[model samples]
Target: MRIIILFLFFIAVGVGAFSQTPKKKVGADNRAVPTKNKIQSQMNEATSGIAKEIADLEEQLKTETDEETIKNLKEQIGMLKKQLKMMQGLNKNVSNMSNKVIQQAFNSETSEIPKRDVNRINSLPKKILNDGELFVFMKQTTQEVENKLAIEGKKLGMQLFDTLKARKYSAQAMGQYAFACMAGGFPEMGLYIYGKACLADMNNADNLNNYAAYLTMAGGEQYSIPILDNLNSKYPFNSTILNNLGQAWFGLGDMNKAKKNLEDAVRIYSIHSRANETLCLIQQSEGQTQQATES
Candidate 1:
């Protein structure tokens, strides 16, 4: 699934005509700061658990007489082994780096998006708007307006921008605005707005997930990986997060890691279309015709 998963930001417009604006570097002052020791400990424990599970499954395979059961056990063991390897690699990487170094690396990677300018908005006190309100506003303003040529559309865009700067919108609202910008043919602005949204609310899982997705779509998979990894640590069973992480690894040409995460995602949620499709593609690429067809 190399296609962009525009979950709710689908807009019928010619996005190709517009040249992407130069990215403005933004600081990572509000990013979800990871604790090196804690994450390492968690990964170590998870690796141990996976290793033990693999051992148990291998033992079961040894004693099982039913061919079907044996096949399932072997498959489980193989998946577990891959997971073990991934965890060990992650632990090694995390253990070798200091928290400051990790943070610096992340900041450097995500410096393309522009920082929010607090001074652009009005100074008067106003009620903070939510995502729903912002979305309605976006819909109303974008109706029948072509941002690139139409004067009305340009005015609307400025109105939207000014409104965003006018007050400290909620994180969810910022996320919505980011989507609107992207769907409405403003990729650079969308990225910038979403970057600030992620910074403002790093704890929100949806916010982080969407941000990573945007980065991956924009050929910034290297930057998305860290965020996806952190999100994975917090929500190990989230299929969407695992799928996104797998896509990022695939984008970086790490087939093993990509396969591992995609497999985990599909195993957790068999109905995940993107994960299943990607896994199938990997199998086809490797000449595993039977496996690919089955997938």
Candidate 2:
């Protein structure tokens, strides 16, 4: 019956809502049981109940044109589709948050990520889709490479290098490749990837920033000095690039200029960790450690 189907739908939704924690968060509760997974199991049960009811309605209704039966079936199908979409979205969020946690862990410990999450990330298909979804997936996968993930990230990127060999390139995809290259500690490769994207779209700031970022990261202050100067010339008041420039100046022992660039950078991006840290260092150098402490 239509009324019975509706009741089952509400029950499934209720279960999904309660079992909202990600699969990776198991053993996170005081009860030593993951509440979310329990709820997910319940949802699976309720989904089975809906399937049974739908099957019963289909068998009992003789004609496809029976308006009530047709309408009920359509509603059931729609509900299933919506739930699938919700699940996929939840999967993406979970993957992203897990990647962040892993990055922080690496920063503190300087070690490899667990093989499980690494294998899970690597399992994403190498083939990029046309719907612009592939970029997000690739980006998520690349995040596994904290400073410690350099080698694994290289392997993952190289796995798909063959896929693009004969394929027509897009700036969007190449930009993502640039990201992977940078994270993997291949600045030359990173610049090469960004260069391909820039060749496709010369004025793309995303590509330009990556180019600048790798230059700074690779050669320390020497190469970064000229690059940052040029970048600041264009985006004079841009905090992100300026912050980078300050660090370069510091590396070159240009204390006065480092202090200036860092001051402007922190002014523009008040809460930026790198900029604030660099600025604090410069202040300490200036015999103003007290001022840096206040900051």
Candidate 3:
């Protein structure tokens, strides 16, 4: 009887130990969560692939080929070179990490962001010294505005506005700062920045599109329409551009035109959040009117 009791106790202890053990969470690839090492490994693998492609393209160039095909291959090689540079830019500290690991870190700190400081805003430079300063300042202010801290977004936006006016910066940077203004609840300033960005870089499709959309929002539909039309003509199949054009039409109270562009946006990218939200708003408004008439 004593032996039997001891055996039973051992069995119960074993079961409890098993229950306390942690399980490995398998992701879609049926593996444990990725680590920095995994990210580094993936980057290395991509680098190897790019190198292989470059070699193969060189071989193709050596072979007899048509002029057009040769030009395309050269362009592809150039693109691969750019990718190689970008891959090499990965920091040594994070070189070993996987995207999942980075994402996890980002998620952990998402809510720990500090609030905006009014004193800092009040004493900020009247004009950013350079594009790099502009970028860093915008990054610092982005979280503040997004968190909706005590500081007014307009104040930060005005600083960007002044910076653009007082100093020279890249067109891309100008467009980005302008977007910050728009998000900070200063649509007028955003439009001005967008205009400057577009003027500086007419070939910048992004700035042109954003400027047109802001113009529409600011009740400059007549000015924005032509620009949107020109973009549509240029990028007939780009979903984001189409969505912006639709938004411009919506601002003009042209439901039919808005629906057409918005529909095209959905067809191009089913998961487009902005296009879906606009469609829902239109539907809800029409539904409410119909219900009111019925009552």
The true-versus-predicted C-alpha distance at residue 101 of model 2, in Å, is 7.0
Q: Candidate 1, residues 1-295: lDDT per residue as tens digits?
A: 0021132211111011012221222122111333466445544554665566567667777889999778666755664465466556656766787877654543332212222223321321143324444334323322312332345434434444444555556876666666544533445545565655655665555666676676676655655666667656555666666778887777666677788998987777675555666677778778899987877
In the predicted model 1, the residue pairs found to clash are none
State model 3's lDDT. Answer: 0.50
RMSD (CA, Å), each prediction: 23.5, 19.2, 23.1
Q: In candidate 2, residue 266 scores what lDDT?
A: 68
Clashing residue pairs in all predictions, respectively, total 0, 0, 4
Q: TM-score for all predictions?
A: 0.48, 0.44, 0.41
Local distance difference test scores for all models: 0.54, 0.44, 0.50
Q: How would you encode candidate 3's per-residue C-alpha lDDT over 1-295 as one tens digit per residue? A: 2221111111111111212212321112211123355445544654665567678777888994699878766765665565456555642545555555554452231112123333433443544224344334434433333344233434444444454555566787677556433433344445555665666666565666566555544445545556656656655655555666676666656666666897787676655545555655555555655522322
> Which candidate should be chosen as best, given TM-score against the real structure?
1
Error of 2 at 199 (Å): 4.6
Candidate 3 Cα deviation (angstroms), residue 151: 22
Pitting candidate 2 against candidate 3, the one with the higher TM-score is: 2
Per-residue lDDT, model 1, residue 92, is: 72
Name the lDDT value of residue 173 in candidate 2. Answer: 57
